[model samples]
Target chain A: MKKRITEPVKKPAVWIGFGVLFTLVTPWYFPAGSWSPLFWGIPYWALIIIAVSLALSIFITWVVLCQWDTGADETEDER
Target chain B: MNMELAFGGWSGILVLGLYGGLMLAVGLFAFLRHRGVRESLDEYYLGGRGLGAMVLFFTFFATQYSGNTVVGYPPTAYRLGYQYLVSVPFFIMIIMVYLFFAPRLYSLGRRFSLLTPVDWIDLRFRSKRVSVLAAILMLYGLGNYLLEQFVAIGQGVSGLTGGTIPYQVGVIFFIVIMVAYSWLGGMRSVAYTDTIQGLALLFGVFTLLIGSLIYLGGLPSAAATMAANAPQKLGAPTGTALTTWFCLLVLVGIGAAIYPHAFQRIFSARSERTLKRSFIRMAYMPFLTAGVVFMVGIIGISAFPDLTTAQSEQLVGMLANALANQNAFFYWAMVLLFGGVIAAIVSTADSVLLTFSSIISHDLYGRYVAPDASEYRKILVGKLVGVAAVVVLVLIAWYPPGTLYQIFVLKFEVLIQTAPALILGLYWRRLNTQAVFVGMLAGTILAAAFTFAGYRPLGVFSGLWGLSLNLLLCVGGSLLFGASPAQRERAEEIIAFPPSAAAARAV
Candidate 1:
């Protein structure tokens, strides 16, 4: 039984992306009393960071979906 | 508080009775359609792999976001104010965590005919000990999670009825409806009920928001009230609260993604495309569910003002009472909102019960105890376990118990213990199976120890603290005492670039 990952296991890229987005999302990075960059009344910081988080989520989903093999023969019967 | 009814009297009871009857009819219908043909475990548990994107999405949505978000979170927001805005993103982060395992797990689930997440653990580790332990953790966590929903059910029933129904009666009525559908219909029944509940929840939330704004004023006014009375509530995150926010994001994100019920949904997805689309849409739901609850709590700051912790849990009750006093429209909307909250909890409990039964029947009894058990016997065991689990959870709920958040976090901590095995198996070939076993065990121990001791590191969740140490052992121990060449070759074979025999067999 060969160990298999249907998609390339790209760890570093995913982790770094998560790290950056996480840093941006938290309020600690901002100085006290300063309004974050504005997106519909939210701080600019929150909107920007959530955008990054949003992007990361999409990328991870894409990466996961890519692993699907529509052509792979059924393994249940073979086993 | 034998308060007068604005729209209630029987409008509320009629609406609720209709909703409950409809849920049962759907479950009974699905059971009749699928019961005879469900000769295989896959047909029953995964709906024969035919669930469309919409059904799959709503089912997954119902499982992940529950009554807690609707009935519980506002109180936290009411108490803590803007500081709890973190709840919104934390919900989003759960989807992000799913990205880590969704692609690979879904593919493997389809390949191996996997029934539960523990089956995946069995495939990855090939260790009975690891698989059994994971199942136990799942069962324990799920039992606790189900109990929390029961508590919410009681609260929601009483709140909605204005105490027209007692708390115990409320819990029993809904639990009976839930068990009937779930026992008879499996995942299909659960998903259909979820669809109804999800729609009701969406309608109720928007209505509450509109009604609240019309009567209580908008967020800015509420913010002003917080700014005046409890300045810290409106202040920026700092000290322990900020650190806890980040910890919550990671803890909940990973913990939620790996939930047995959510993982089962990965198997239930009709296709990779369906799963992908569901999540893409899900990225915005925090805005609707969590975001609305956050708004509700924010309004509470001004509306009720200075509620004690126990009193704070009654935010929804307080708001509904106030709304009912206002006028007829507000009264009706409040009743619907309370009904939706109870429905949401029932839907979540059904999912948890389904997964719990699957773990017992498929993972433990079928795989280890009786590998050749017939599909009928397996389904029977699963259903029986589901009923038994509900019985125990109801008893636990009956006793005065822990805070909603505490029970919720405890579920995550237990589930996260399995991460090293599932996530690492995808990428780390040299993650020695014994090392994976030891790491997961140690991680769970540390998490439980810290949790029981009232030790929350830096005010972060105790589970992440355990996970930190767990990941270290898995990676560090693997490097220090490397696997034999044969084992390394086996590892490479198990985690290679393309689907292989070992990977296909994964749970």
Candidate 2:
């Protein structure tokens, strides 16, 4: 089987998703109300950001893996 | 500085010593194994350009996310509030910038055996002066960058350890290990240790988050405290702050993507596919590392509000103190966190040192100074220079004239100047060698001027202002002079390789 080399696409949805991820990681959406939920003093928004950030990592890993497979297959076919 | 309280007493020392020893062992092992065949420059400098995905990813990760991500970023978030969340995406956007150039660069690197950015310049422009100047600029930027990491190591170690080791001792200890390893394994040692260090850093951060959340009352309580006390930190960037965020997005996006060490990794990839895949994944790391630190800083705003810059800089230190007082589990977590901080710093330094030496070995001494020099001689020169660089950098760190952040940006300003020659030479057929040379020089000067002048163009970084001017000159000058028929043909040939290859690969 010939290997494939995947060319990068300028996908609008991917770009938009990136923009959303950027915005989400920022602290812009924290509401004005504060209910004290003390888990030894760490904050809810902080934890939420960390969780979201971790999810972002997993998502990135998925995306990169897809790019790798496609690109590798394409490149090998060229050879 | 809480010298007595900082080290976590015996545990901290043991951890630091163990980590340092491991790094040294990696370095020495690489040196001894590869030293016999030092004649092979590719093997010595780039690990024969055969890194797998995991090593490449972790090495790249360490290059971008460092101890600075841990110790410095939180205080930035604490001070700027939620507005500084710009740091996260700015990092992500750097990978986005990579998408524009890295694939093509990788293809070209393989074609010409390009080891440094200067090699690319040599191929593209075929101008001796242009290649030489780019090499010098890279060396300067990389040297200062490595120095910045050294300084951070000192500050991060003492700060995280609550001053147990003091700045000088901490900086020396890690830098020595970094130099030893880089001299031995070159890129291989750096990448291997980066994997270990990156893991330690991740573990440290997650533990801190878990502990901080349990101790602090979670984000809701922290947000309540922030909103009640100082809402501005959590508020959106407005006026100067908003402009600054936009500025940060552009400056860091371009500047960091163009960092010399980063470009080296682009060359180090096993294949174009590996490079592209790594970058795609890199885009999301900000959330994991920077976002985590930013959160810790935000919580600190409430937990220990009203601390000075120096005090806030020691936010992790103060938290560790408080955490230790809480329980044994918290104490161990704090210890791990400090170790992570040091590990991150060392990882960054080792990578920087590796690239710094490669530039000297491959570009300066190897290319112009002595094209016929054996790989052993080249590696030896690079290593000696690297060790000397560390020594001088340690002294400067002991007396860092300005704020660490200022010195940090100064390094980027110089590094970012190469963007025109690097990114533009890829797509622009009419890019003149003279234009590239002038544009890079002009861009660098303007960046420095803007930085030194403290001229924030509408709250954006001076470097961005310089880059804008640089790009204008490059594009405009290229049009005026135009590409020679030969230049145009060469560019067409290079650019045409990919799509055709992709088509061929697809078929």
Candidate 3:
């Protein structure tokens, strides 16, 4: 079987995905000083931001696991 | 953060003293196991480059989330409301930033046996001036960082012990304990204690959050308080708040990932897989640590309403005190929480001090001051200088110069300026050394001036401003005058990634 060696930095899809996730995390797109529709005490916009933050984490997990093998530790893996 | 509520002085003192003893024991244990820790720089500083996934994760944890996350961040959350929610994503952003450079850097570290971040700079540029400037910036930044930890340790100790242990005494006691253990086993000791400290901090914050929820109502009550009194806290950020939020994400994301100590940690990973695993753990930590603390702070709003900003800074202590009063179980837990706070501070200080000494031992003293010195002698010199630095910083903590305090506070702001040289050097082969040096120096000066003058153009942080100019000059200058052919070849040899299949087989 062949090794699937790659790096996150070499992947354009990873970059594009991160760019989108980072933009959503900042919560600027929401209306200013308008936080009605509070859910369990968290405002509506805040919930989206939380979900976005989680997405960033999950995206990071995917990048780390699936897209970041550089074959730098091939010997260790063999061991 | 200044908290007046003391959780029964004797328990605080007892727990802290026992905690210090346990740390000393851990150091002794590491020393016994790794007998060569003092004789070799790698064994001493990077734990033989054998840190497992868990130790590396906790050590990284200790670096980014210091005691301040517990003692300081909650107060900011209480004052600012959900706007401080940015803290969570910003920390996640740090891991995101790391994905850009860490993969290649880790490979390079393995190839070169890079001992410190400065060693990487030296290998990449081979310029004394550039490497030395980077070292001084890192040392100055780490020194300031250590000093801030010392200050926080004092405040945390005094707050926990209810003034029984004066701030001066508290600082001195922890410094002694920290220096003692660090001398015993070096990086092994720091990483081991960081595991313990990280666990304690996690337990403490979870308890605080649960206690706040049960004892002082939940976020809904806090949201109501904000809606009735200050709706802006609950509302999504806009205007200056929005800009501040964006600046925080960018500054903290890049700055923290390249913290000299944090950068050096990449060299300490046992393997690529270990490092990747540790980062995965870290990518989610902000939710557990910062997210929980933010909730505790929000709960503080309804529990103690209308506190002046000054008093709101005491939110954690006030909350801890209320919890302790409710039951015995809570009383002990709150005490442990304060102990965790102090432990977190010490863990951070230990790592900074270790990296500070490595720069002196491996980069400056070993390289320049005494070229023929043995590794043992170099290590000894680094330890003594580190101790000397601790004394100076502790004195500064005690007798803080009134107007000069801003210089000490420039730790992160100035340190962030080194990001371009450190990170860009990893990938961009044509990055000119002269451009790096000039950009770093210019950026630091601009950042210091803006920070001291309280000048933030368009609600952006001074550090981010400095970073922008730094990047501009670094990228623009490199474009105008790229590396020479020979320099290009060397950079290609160093950073061309994976080193080709044949080279790896030969190694």
Best candidate according to DockQ: 3
Clashing pairs in 3: none
Provide the lowest-lDDT 10-residue window in model 1 chain B.
B1-10
Q: How well is each residue in A1-79 modelled by candidate 3, as lDDT tens digits?
A: 7678788998999999999999889887888888999999999998999999999999999999999988878855665
**Model 2 stretches astray by more than 4 angstroms:** A1-6, A9-79, B1-7, B29-37, B159-166, B400-409, B499-507
Q: TM-score of every model?
A: 0.89, 0.87, 0.98
lDDT, each prediction = 0.76, 0.73, 0.91
Tens digit per residue, CA lDDT, model 1, B247-337 = 8888888888888898888888777667777887787788788888888878877777778888888777777777777888777787887
Candidate 3: tens digits of C-alpha lDDT, residues B375-410: 999999999999999889988988989886898989
Model 3 share of native interface contacts: 0.86
- Interface RMSD against the true structure, candidate 1: 3.7
Q: What is the overall TM-score of model 1 with all chains considered together?
A: 0.89
| DockQ value for model 1 | 0.28
How much is the lDDT of residue B26 in candidate 1? 94
At residue B501, what lDDT does model 1 achieve?
Answer: 52
lDDT by residue (tens digit), candidate 2, B80-181? 776676777677767766765776677667766788777787778878878888888888888787777777677666655556678788887887777777
For candidate 1, what's the TM-score of chain A, rounded to 2 decimals? 0.52
- lDDT head-to-head 1 vs 3, winner: 3
For all candidates, what are the clash counts?
Answer: 14, 31, 0
